[model samples]
Target: MGWLIFVWALTACTENPVDHDIRPPTTLEGEWLVTAINDEPLTTANGQAGSWLGFSAGAEVVRWEPGCAQLMFLYTVDSDDFRADAIRYNVPYDKPIFVPSKFMPPPCAIGWPPRLEEAMEAMSLARKIELTQSGSVLLSGEGRSITVRPR
Candidate 1:
């Protein structure tokens, strides 16, 4: 009886094998700096030029500032599915919305940065978020993708 009980206890105490095939979805609840656009590497110069995204999981909001303007989006995520709707701000045309009042150039002078335009277009088209093996986040859709890394 003692031997049988010891055998039973040993079997019961054995650890279950971990399932390496399954993994929890990656989270998108922190600040991320843009690293690439459509597979093209974004240089430090271009990244510094302004291209970053921050997500607030609690608030369900994502904020992106791309050089000339600040943009906000209300977002939702389920597993790998992700969606974002731009939050429009009613700006009174009388005020200057450009950053750094002194060094405003062509695009900024016009109140629209070309990079911002491209980013907005890509974001609007994005419908999925994927985690790369390298730990970067890829937001992609309609053949366009934006890769970002944790800040």
Candidate 2:
């Protein structure tokens, strides 16, 4: 009986070979550096470049510093694709709503409220973000792409 079971296992293994070279998806749970954006090499008018990006594995939140603006959004994931909605909090603006202040969150924050949503759309359209196993390619519906390496 044991021999019969072993034979079945052997047949299964022979029929479906395993690809041991494949690694799992990268855990996009920590900090990611802004290597480049919109294919322009992440430059800044004020010399404050290459913003930081953060992802919270526990809350499905994405923290982005596109320039000097810190924006937070709740994103929905379908496989490797991500769909993020309106900015939940515009760090520099959201916190200063009631005050007459000229304070900004950080240097990474940039863009006015009028154009911020557009930026969000552009960012999200890169629909899918595949990590280490796939060499971290960002694919957009309009054929635009962004590439990032683990930092």
Judge candidate 1 against the unseen true structure and give its global Cα lDDT, from 0 to 1.
0.58
Instruction: For each candidate, give its TM-score against the true structure.
Output: 0.58, 0.44
Kindly list the per-residue Cα lDDT of model 1 for residues 93-137, writing each as its tens digit.
343332333333333334543455455556657787776656676
Residue-level lDDT tens digits of model 2 in 3-118: 99999898665412322354423334555544344443443456675434423332466565453454555666566665655353333644432122445334433444333343
In TM-score terms, which candidate is top? Answer: 1
Model 1 pairs in collision: none
Cα lDDT computed for each candidate against the true fold: 0.58, 0.46
* Residue pairs in collision within model 2: 67-108, 67-109, 68-107, 68-108, 68-109, 68-110, 69-108, 69-109, 69-110
How many residue pairs clash in all the candidates, one count each?
Answer: 0, 9
Q: What's the CA RMSD of model 1 in angstroms?
A: 14.6
What lDDT is reached at residue 105 by model 2?
A: 36
